[model samples]
Target chain A: MFAIEANGQKIEAKKGETILQTLTRAGINVPTICHMEGLLPSGTCRMCVVEVEGFGGLVPSCSHPVAEGMKIRTNTPEVMQTRKTIIDLLLSNHPDDCLYCARNGNCDLAKLAADNGVRDRTFHGERTHRPKDISSPAIIRDPDKCILCGKCVRMCEEIQGVSAIDFVNRGSKAYVGTAFNEGLNVSSCISCGQCILVCPTAALSEHKYIDEVLQALADPEMMVVVQHAPAVSVSIAEEFGFKPGTDFDGKMVAALRRVGFDRVFDTSFAADLTIMEEGSELVHRVQNNGPLPMFTSCSPGWVKFVEQFYPEFLPNVSTCKSPQQMMGAVIKSFFAEKENLDPKKIVSVSIMPCTAKKFECGRPEMGRDFVPDVDFVLTTRELAELFRITGVNPAAIEPEPPDNPFGERSSAGKLFGASGGVMEAAIRSAYFLLTGEELKEYKIQDLRGMKGSKELRVKIGDLEVGAAVVSSLGQARKLMDEIKAGRSDIHFIEVMTCPGGCINGGGQPIGADQEAIKARMNALYQIDRDDRLRVSHKNEWVQRLYTEFLGKPLGHKSHELLHTHYEKREVLL
Target chain B: MPTVKSVETILKEHPNAGRDHLIPILQEVQESEGFLSQESITKVGRALNLPSSKIFGVATFFNMFRFQPKGKYHVMVCRGTACHVKGSGKSLDMVTKTLKIQPGETSRDKLFSLEIVACMGACGLAPVVNINGQFYAKISPMKLQRIIEECREKEQTHANA
Candidate 1:
């Protein structure tokens, strides 16, 4: 380490660390828009430019390495003016629709301007007059609002390995768009919305369903019911001033109640239902010598990725519907029958930490009885906005339990928030189904944490069942190539599109750091450790549903309500 | 004209090529087919193991590649600062109205394609139009009409032969 003076304070700087990293470690807040952790620093955003004592020009601290005996001035008057001028030019050409924009208060450019005390648009120019692109089911692209940060372009190409959008045209005329400037639906876009999460402005956002959901809830005739996904409760708390990974499961239910939902249910309860069907399906496949490696079909983004990139693996994917869809299916069918309400009147909504769930709920196959299984899917941000509009803060409200018949869930179901949770949940019940006994330990340490790819082997009565868990489509592609090259040891594989699973899903809180994701991930593991029922097979309510409504796991009723099919999608038009 | 060679024929030239060679692959296909067809782009992506979106991104970024086929007679009217300061804009307009086609477009009869180029290195001839590699220097709108008619008459004679 070498000594460096930052604001007249001497500190040791690591050998290869950037000036930005060293300054950040010392609690000096530097504003940045284009720099994201784990991504190559482009230094395109000049917001992090700082003055080095010996250097001739102000350098971008994000990419410039700190030298020995270097003196850095991060907040000098000249540097501040330069930063303010760069932002002023950006704001001059940017659209002035922040009041009606999707990320009005959450926009990075707006926040930077406010922090810099730039109240007036001293430098004014022409803004791009492009119309908003709402062609995709889950995402919107507004070129006029883009600051040309290229965050979405890098996120889509580098992280997700889906080059649906890129820089098209030249220089000032260039903008992020699909091939041939066509709609995103025609391109190889999978509607993951990972781009929206990294976008510093409202250039990209989830297609809004707030208006439709609000209208449905206000209708007296419609019996609007909502379900919270396993990961949403943990991440949504961050929007309400709660620490990341702070579990507000009960208080969230109370907030939803105050927001006028007729009934609230837990998607984890339906996750238990998924384990029964998927676990039994795995057992049957293994016994009958079916496909060797079975892929989990919960994350819709991963399912769409398989459909577009790896169509051959469609058969290997388990046919179970996602827990969110299962809850919707049950709510529209069984709940309709029990309450004696018209199936059409029961508008099923899902609160999920995923933007892809919006597209999944609208799939043609998800409709039954001439009505869609889920009516509207809201992201955690949208639900938080709903609570704000309703003046129902979780902090002020008393916690309440979820409605019965679809409320009580095993800790195994709650594990679905993390990456390997699905495989772990499935194995806990699958081992019992095959051996007639539970595993010695409840928590499978092998399938936990934020590792990109992992392998675990569980021996069940002379049968060695091997499973693999992967997060991020890029990593999934590498593992898939290995599988195609004939890695037959893998039996069950779980893939989550977002890197840290649903807890760190694209629809979760934006600007969430690595620590935030880990906290949210650990919160789910904590819930699993605290719950009495460690396995899905031990959930008495799920057992009751099998006995009272559905006959058995993978049986007729279970297949009708829980299983779904896949189709190969055309790559280009 | 139909695509004489499949994308595989061009891709076979680079068996181990990946996404980096997308531009070269597109250039090869456009050279043979006279345009980058949707089928060729998709097939090139499959052969290169790259997403079609990335292929399209590269194809659209450069001004040289055309999605649609050009007309039998390709005409480029230079609009360099030298030509623009002179009277190339009027010449471009006259040509468009004569063919009833805009710049970067082909006529319905497939007789001519129009393009507005920044320069053709013939600024000595203040206003120049390059037609099928032959330069018509110091051109006028009325003279341009007569020159196009002369080309049409030559085409008719060639067809009759």
Candidate 2:
């Protein structure tokens, strides 16, 4: 703990806690959006400003740390007025159509406006109108509703480590978005959807594939198969007003069945497949020296981040497709083959906690046999909306089981939804594949848990495998800079665009504060520890998939179904 | 490059470069060499033990930093809310027309660099343009030509001296 005095208040705080954290812990509320305690302090939204006795002017309390004997003032009339003016300025360009907005009933920005008693748009001028970006399959961006508070940017940069969104200009004209207001579909944006989770308004939201799913259900010819990502089990219950970390896997299956989907599939099965492909890819890379840093491509945000900022390191990214995309490809190829249905007729719908999945599904590179692996991507909220549309009360539904083959997933596959789980799952399999011996030392200690940046080198037989894991894009930037400068010796890096992995993806349930998200992450980690079969290779279903369908990782079948390429494009509105 | 190093040396001698170095370093380099150069980035990186790419990354990332060298005289047009309401865009358009360069672009003659900044924290003055740190208030399209002619005269005289 660090000792510090702020505004004559003697306080003891964690050594690393920011001034905002110390102040908040001491009962002082600072106005800020991009500065959640668990997340990185963005310092982009400069609203939580305070006048330090020694410092000349007001400093942003969110990023600034308290010093010994420091004087801090909460309700200085000047500070209050400044805050009001900032809010007023933000409201000027913001859309007044909150009544019809998706987040009307539950918007933090709206609540702030009401709490502050701000009644008018003081700066009346010609609005800098930007068209809504609805190009992606999962997320939507209504620029008019954006306050430029930078919560979305921070979430993208810090939590996801994707760095997909950023400030384009300076001051009032400055807007938060991809390069030239390019739709997420075209930009190097990974579809993690963490940006949507932290956004204060409906400026960024999940693309509603729920409507498409409904349409498919309405069309009797469409055999709509719904797949739930592993993280969805712990989080989907929240939409039904159930507590976070609740295992609603049964309820989810029941809900999908009730909603009239032909099959309710577990993405965990595909996740198990990912561990096989990705884990094997890691070993192949380490052995053959294909790419030193084989980055995980599961998180779209990380993929996009690598594409935009670190294009030189693109080879480092694993060619293995994400679980959603892998499932989509297989559902179109293998599932369609096995079920005796045309690939085009099998409507593959994925229920994700990500907004980025919408964009990922629409990628030109995602098509195999001229059919996108996943036809539609819906966030947990959109699924909730679908539940409402179908008139299915999740609470009233009877718990059911997912269909066979794809339904058989180990806890290793289930853990893929969280941060460090991918690396953990991959190493569990990779260690065995490389050494031809059971890994008594299964845990890759360096690749477990969240920090600004993590780097480690481990010996796998004769080869020393180097790896790095970073949750936030800001941290990714730092790591990337290190890589660019030839400072990083890492080989197989696992980067999840979302901070706590897909469990805390962008399109998850709204209003999930720092504590709520952390609780969810902790629960997933516990599940990973509790599971008897914690290795992907140990999953019987995965072994069977390799034996029956896919011959090997990076093999012809694997490449056809589990690997994809990236294209660099200039983003335009 | 020498100019950037000199400025960095000067900054190293200053009191508070530890925490508030990046902005100050940028400001000093811009002052000494008319804008931030690739050389300045390398020097800063070497001095700070920060990566040269990181320094360049930070410079390019911020909107405030200017990458290319500018003209001897800097002409800035205010595009704040008050200024915009009073037709700062039209005023900027006129400046753009006369200078034969867009906002943020310097004239090939090295005589002027035109830029548009928001507000300048001066709202009461309404539409404002600053020439080499000297404020010109309530500027319209017609008044812009005279200002340009005056800047030309001042630059010519200063050069002669």
Candidate 3:
């Protein structure tokens, strides 16, 4: 450690650390736009400029290395003026439609501007009025509101490694665009919506289905049924000003009832249904000389990634539809029949902690009828806004149970919200099927946590079952490459497209750091530990459904509703 | 005339290239094909293990690489400080308006391509417009239009012959 004077206070700075890191370590609040922790500091935004004692010019604290006995003034008049000028210039070219923007009060740029006392635009010039891009089923891109901070650009490139969008043109005319300036649907975008999480403006966001969901709710002819994903129960609380790890599952069901949904169910039940189908499929593949190392297909982003880049692995992936899709089909088919209502008149809306779910529901193979499986998909953040507008506070309302039959889910289904949770759950159930005995203790620590890729091995009746859990498409690519390169030890893999799985999904609450994501993951694990029904096969209702309707896992009726196939995309558009 | 390598041939030479070789490969492709085609970009992206959008970003960052196919005669109107002072902006507007095209676009007849360059390091000939490496000094918008018509006439005569 070296001594440095930050804002006239003596502090010890770490070796080889930047001034920004030192200040951040000391709990100094320096506003930044383009400085991400893992990414290389481009210093293009000029928002973190600070005054150094010896330097003649203001330095970017993000990239500038800390020196011993160095005096750095973070909030000097000169630094303040420079930051204000930068903010003023950015605001001048901005769209000036804050009230209508998706990120109105939650914007990083607006927050920084407010902190720096930028009351009005000081400079005005010719602004680029680029058209909005809503071509993708999941995301919407408003080019005009983009401040060119390059956060979304770098996040899409460096983190996801998708490279669907990048900085096009040059200087002032420079904008983020796809190849040939084509719409996002024509690009290699997987509809992960990770870009929306990093954007400091309303330039990137998940496509809203709020209006359609409301219209369906208002219609007396339509019976609106809403379901919340497992991850949404844990993470949606963050959007409602609650603590990150708060479990709002019961309150969420109550809120959905208030939102005019005739039936509110838990997607966890469908997650349990997914495990039954997917786990059985894995077993059959292992026994019958079918495809080895069957990949999990719950995460829609991961499904698209495999379809686009690794088409050869289509046969290797489990044919089970995601929990959201399963819930949609089950609701419109089984639930509709139970209620003596027409499936066409029943509008199904799913609240997910994912942007990809919006795209997944509209897939050509998702539904039984001509219409989609799920009519509308809303992100957790979107649902939070609905709760806010309708005054349905989760804290204020009395907790209620979800609708019966599809509402009761095992703790194994709740674990589906986090990375490796699927593999852990599957292993528990797979062991029971192969050995006819429980594992005694359920928590598989090897498959838990926030690491991108993990590997674990277990034996079931002298048969070694090799399993790997991979989060993020980039990590999925790495593990797949390893497997293709003669690493045949892995017999099963669980892949979630977003980092840390659904807890940190693209459509979850914004401003969630690594700590917040870890908290949410731990909370899901806590729920699994506390709940008595920790295994999918142990769920009485699931067993009843299998016996009454589907017969057994991977049966004919199960194949029709719970399973689907994937095709290689021609242009990966 | 120099021998030009095909994009596939050029890509084959860089067998283990990654995203870093994107610019160098794009430069070679533009040099060979005169501009980056959508199909060629896709092919290059596959070779480099990068997305076409990222490749397009790299190709577009540099002003030299054009997106569309340039016509036989490339028309460059200088918008440098000296040229701007001499009212080259009006000439640029007039040329684009007449052709019903924007900067970096070809005429439907494939006779002329329009571009507004910053400077050609020739301030002595203020308000200069260059057509196929031949500089037309102190040219007005009307003069540029007449030059385009003459080029079209030459193409027509050559076709007849």
Q: Pick by lDDT: which candidate is best?
A: 3
Instruction: Give the Cα-based TM-score of candidate 1 against the true structure.
Output: 0.93
Q: Lowest summed-lDDT stretch of 10 residues in model 1 chain A? A: A123-132
What digit string (tens of lDDT, one per residue) describes model 1 on residues A265-293? 99999999999988888888998999869
For model 1, the superposed segments whose C-alpha errors exceed 4 Å read B1-5, B71-73, B87-113, B131-136, B139-161
Score residue A478 of candidate 1 by CA lDDT.
90
Query: In TM-score terms, which candidate is top?
Result: 3
Model 1 clash pairs are none
Model 3, range A267-299, lDDT digits (tens) per residue? 999988888889889989998978988999999
Model 3 misplacement above 4 A: B1-5, B13-21, B80-82, B108-111, B118-124, B149-161
Please report, in order, the local distance difference test score of every candidate based on alpha carbons: 0.88, 0.75, 0.88
Per-residue CA lDDT of candidate 2, range A146-253, in tens? 887777666654554444566666566666666434567665466666677677888887766666678899999889998999888788778878777777778879
Global lDDT of model 1:
0.88
- Model 2 has an lDDT value of 0.75
Candidate 3: lDDT of A516? 95
